[model samples]
Target: MKILIIEDEIQLVQSISEYLQTENYTCEYALTYRQAVHKVLKHNYDCILLDLMLPGGDGMQILEEMKRLKKMDGVIIISARGAFEDKISGLQIGADDYLSKPFHLPELAARIYSVVRRRNFGNSNIIDENELQINLLAKTATINNVELSLTKKEFDLLLYFISNRNCVISKNALAEHLSGDIAGMLDNYDYIYAHIKNLKKKLNDAGCRNYLKTIYGSGYKWEI
Candidate 1:
């Protein structure tokens, strides 16, 4: 999934981004409220990790703006202020979850998964689609009770397609989802083809139907 981290602490931001990246999540960072707002306006994010205190403006104001735009993006508030009132206000303002500072990275990761699950996958850890079963927490996929070995990229691609089933996903969109903002720097999306091809092949080899389709000049679709 693609995540936006609106944190002012450079070390914390880098650590969180690196940790999430290791788990196959594409991350973008914004150190100030202005930069955060610019990113929210420019790109689509699966979830946003927002810090309450920020330079230039408060993160609550950013949340208000997002709600005004009807963005429907999931948000998790992370702040040093651990007061009950702060948590209450965040939830009242539509924050999906809250995490106090000095929290464990793994705990933060789990919270992000929970928020995304609630927002996109019906709040379930196990996503089942007929013969295909995916354990989001374990990051494993099984076809007809048989585990299919997949590279991290292949697994992420499959999950992305499944979550957005029936929607036509353009190559550029897929590239951006997989690589985040840096996708724009690439010359071509040849890597996307490679990942999709490998994922499809692996699934088919494991007795899964060809649910992934290529649309000539358009892109791909996951027709489950």
Candidate 2:
């Protein structure tokens, strides 16, 4: 999943990014209100770690912008301000969860997983898509009662594709989702192609239909 971290503290941002990356999450950053607003407007993320205080503007304004635009991206306010009023206001403005500054990285990861899971799976840890079943917590996939030995990246790619099934997904979006920090510097998408090929082969070997379709001169679509 993709995450946006909106915080001005360089050290905190780096730490969060590194920790989340280890949890198999792709992260992007916005150190200022303007940058945060711009990224929120231009791209879609599974979750956003928002800091209430920002350089250019108050982070509450970002919440308002999201509300105005009717964006459904899950947001978790991670601010140093632990006031009761701040928590209430953030939830009232549509944040999914609130975490104070002095929190553990594992807890923060857990919250992010909860938010993304609720947003995408609607209270279920297991995703059932046709004959394909995925246990989100275990990060395992099975098709037609046969298990596939998929790499972590392959499993994640499969889940992402299935979640967004029948929708056209660009190579750039996949690259960014799969490769967090290195995405911005990517000059080619060969790695994506390799992963897709391997995933398709594995699925096909398991007697699953090839539902992933390539759009010539465009990107890919999970036709299922």
Candidate 3:
């Protein structure tokens, strides 16, 4: 899954990004409110770690904008402001959870896991799509009880396709999703094709049906 850490404190943002990256999550950073708002509006994320205070503006404004724009990105408020009113206001504005500062990294990871599970996987750690079964916590995929030897990127690709099943996903979208914002500016997307090819081959080798489909000039789709 992907996470966005919106924090003004450079040290805090770095710490969060490093920790989350170790937890098998692709993370993007926003050090100021402008960057935060731009990322929130531009891309989709599994979860966002938002700080109430920012360099250019209040983090609450970011949440309000997300609400106004009807973005469904899961948000977790990570801030020094621990008052009940702040929590209520954030939740009312569409935050999925609140985590006060001076908390353990494991707790934050747990909160992210819960929010992402609820938002993307229907609150379940296990996803069952016919003969294919994926365990989110374990980060494993099995087809007909046989585990497929997949790289982390391939597994992430498979999960991304499943999450947006039956929808035509553009190459630009896939590149951004897997490679973060920088990939969006790049001209080439051949790396995405490589990942998809490897994922499909592994799935086919495991005796699974060919659910991965190419949309020709458009993109790719998981036609379940």
Candidate 4:
């Protein structure tokens, strides 16, 4: 899954990014309040790790902006221990969870996965949709009990589709989600097309149903 880290501590950001990378999550960063506001407005992520104290502005304002935009990305407020008021206020403003500093990486991973799964997986580690089965923890997919050989990008693409099934997802969103870089850094969406092509081929060849649909002028959809 894609994660956005809004933290001013460069060391903490690096540590979180490195550890989450090991857990198969693509992470992006915003070290200042301005950067956080920009990303929360423009980009999309499965989960956002938001720190309440920022370099330029209060992080609560960022959450307010997210609410203003009606953005649905799950947010987890990261604050110092004993800041119960901040935690309560953050949850009231729509943060899905809260974590204090000096936390364990494993706990952080579990909390992040919990928030993402609540948004997409419906409280299960496995997604069983008729003939198709996906193991979120394992990052694996299967059709009729036969495992499909998929690249990491391909697996992420499949999960993205299934998670937001029946919605038309634009090429720009797909590109940014799959890429570690920001939206402006992308040259074009040709790489997205390639990934979809390979993903379709693998699914089709594996005797899976053709649920992937291209929306002609808009984007792609999993039209289950």
Query: TM per model?
Result: 0.58, 0.57, 0.56, 0.56
lDDT by residue (tens digit), candidate 3, 1-224: 88999988888877777767766789998998999999999999999999998899999999998899999999999989888899999998899998788654545665686688878766367988999999887889999999989999998778777765666667876776677657848889898888898899899999999999999999887887
Deviation from native of the Cα of residue 95 in model 2, angstroms: 0.2
Error of 1 at 155 (Å): 23
Clashes of each: 0, 0, 0, 0
Better of 2 and 4 by lDDT: 2
Candidate 2 residue pairs that clash: none
Error of 4 at 149 (Å): 33
lDDT for each candidate structure: 0.85, 0.86, 0.84, 0.84
For model 4, residues 17-77, the per-residue Cα lDDT tens digits are 9878866789999999999999888889999999988989999899998898899999998
Q: Name the 10 consecutive residues with the lowest summed lDDT in model 4.
A: 175-184
Residue 177's C-alpha lDDT in candidate 1?
65
Question: Candidate 1 residues 1-224, lDDT tens each?
Answer: 99999999999999889878866789999999899999998888999999989999999999989888988889999999877898998999899999888665655775786678877876367988889999887889999999999999898888777755665667887877678667879999998999999999999999998889998998887886
